[model samples]
Target chain A: MEITINQTPFKLPQGASIAEAIEIFGAEPPYAIALNLTFVHRQRYGETFLTQGDALEIVQPVAGG
Target chain B: MSLPENPDPLVLYGTSFPSRLLLGTAQYPSPEVLRQAVEVSGPSFLTVSLRRQAAGHNETGGQAFWDLLSTLKIPFLPNTAGCHTPEEVWTTAQMAREVFETPWIKLELIGDDYTLQPDTLEMVGVAERLLKDGFKVLPYCTEDLVLCRRLVDIGCEAIMPWAAPIGTGRGALNPYALRLLRERLTVPMLIDAGIGRPSHACEVMEWGFDGVLLNTAVAKAADPIRLAGAFKKAIEAGREAFLGGAMTQRETAAASTPILGTPFWHQNPS
Candidate 1:
């Protein structure tokens, strides 16, 4: 399955949960994940299944001063 | 009739400030602490910078600090701190406008790496562009009266002259130049950087500066929350002193004692 993250598309293995994809991509942890415009909490990543062409946005906190 | 103690609300760019102090949201041990410090500071306005964050890195449980600021409902001043060119500042200002939905931008264009001083030429160019585009520009530059005049001529809403280099905490290094700038510029002027202590902030306010914008002085303090409150009080005190008008120093000495002297202490007790 192919999913877009931060405007970039990436392919993932079959039957991959959001957690597995995150681990595979080595995405920075402790982030906010949104799949198809809906936020998925980190605790729920285990059950949240991914589908083809899913739009996922991972946002991190930046220093603001 | 009984009179209230403090009057004259600090006004900036048509906004009435209940507290003269402005705080920055950075360099705390944690965001929770930063939020608490901000509350303690009691600032009517806070400064935030725009930058790129790597994907999937969150220490505060996926909560962006700006989101927290939005929840707090305080007015945010978006700054273009790291921008070195006119294009970068303009683009950052546009993005800030789109994201924050506010037209106010803190224009900062750094010229040299050592001092981190603003490039006046680039700042003027960007200020003109932003003004034409209908954005309220708050330019942060050195204590150059001519540069401030140019900014005003180019239609900036306010001019922020640096007291010293950004984040050095050296305090006001050029009070004479800053005072000259204050004397010359008709628009609102804020002493923007190198304010290390509450007394330093107070000194600038007492010198008739309209306001002060600082970050490291509070953020890097041993106790940021306490320092924030101190800054708040100091700013208010300084403004009050300025309004009340201080006593002028005399060049010639005036004897505290009466000029008529005693009979030489009764002729030295002869």
Candidate 2:
């Protein structure tokens, strides 16, 4: 199956969790995940599944004004 | 009408802030420098951004920086920096709320690329929607009094008008317009961007603005830490001047010392 993560497509086995997608994407922790424009908490990441064409945003802290 | 007996806090969304200065975490030489700057300057609030967590390139200081901010224990106000659409602003605001655990958001919808001006037409809609969704929307908007008045009518208690475009450091480019805003707008106003010096911050604060927000001016300075201290002092001075009932300007020169008390006396029949 394929789901878009941060606008990038990735291949994974059936029923891939959001945590799996994060690991495969090679991103570290201390970031937040937004599934379909709604926030998915860090504790629930392992169980949060990504459907085909779903948009997931991995947001990290940055400097802003 | 009743008079305010004492100085009041910088109140927004029913919350009070101890300091009138707001700093940004961007463009610092290093996170450590930013930390020291925050410590020395002592702002009650600081602005932060959320970016796509990338691979091997924590361009905006990703996780480590987040941890550093946590240690600082200062409330970080998140911004929708690069979002062009209202939906983008909503998504970014939601993500920021979850990440920072705060409902406060600085809404930025870039309408133009060159001037970095905000989409004035869209700002009101975005602010209304965000407020409906239970987020404290502090919009970065222009000095257009009509548009700002509408925003205030839409239940927005606070609005930030740029002194100049973002990162330009030009200071208040249109003092007339901004001064007009100060005179008419009753809601709390924060001069959010284009402040290049401590004096700029002071001048705006002197105009009865509740606060001033800036980034590049301090972050890109030769001595960011010292510059931070300078801004802190200047903001205080400006706030005090405003509170003390600054004297009215005059077209003709007026002497402070009385003429009657002058030794070289006024009334003489020579």
TM-score of chain A of each: 0.85, 0.90
Total clashes in model 2, counting residue pairs 3 or more apart in sequence or in different chains? 0
What lDDT tens digits, residue by residue, belong to model 1 across residues B199-260?
Answer: 99999899888778878998898888888888888988888888888778899999888868
Flag regions of model 2 displaced more than 4 Å. Answer: A35-48, A51-54, B1-7, B57-59, B264-270
Predicted candidate 2 versus true structure: per-residue lDDT over B129-222, tens digit per residue: 9999899989999999998999999999999999998998889999999999999988999999999999999999999999999789999999
lDDT of 2 at B238: 94
Cα lDDT, model 2, residue A63: 84
| Local distance difference test values of all predictions, in order | 0.76, 0.89
**Model 1: chain A TM-score against the true structure:** 0.85
Give the lowest summed-lDDT range of ten residues in model 1 chain B: B53-62
Docking class of 2: medium
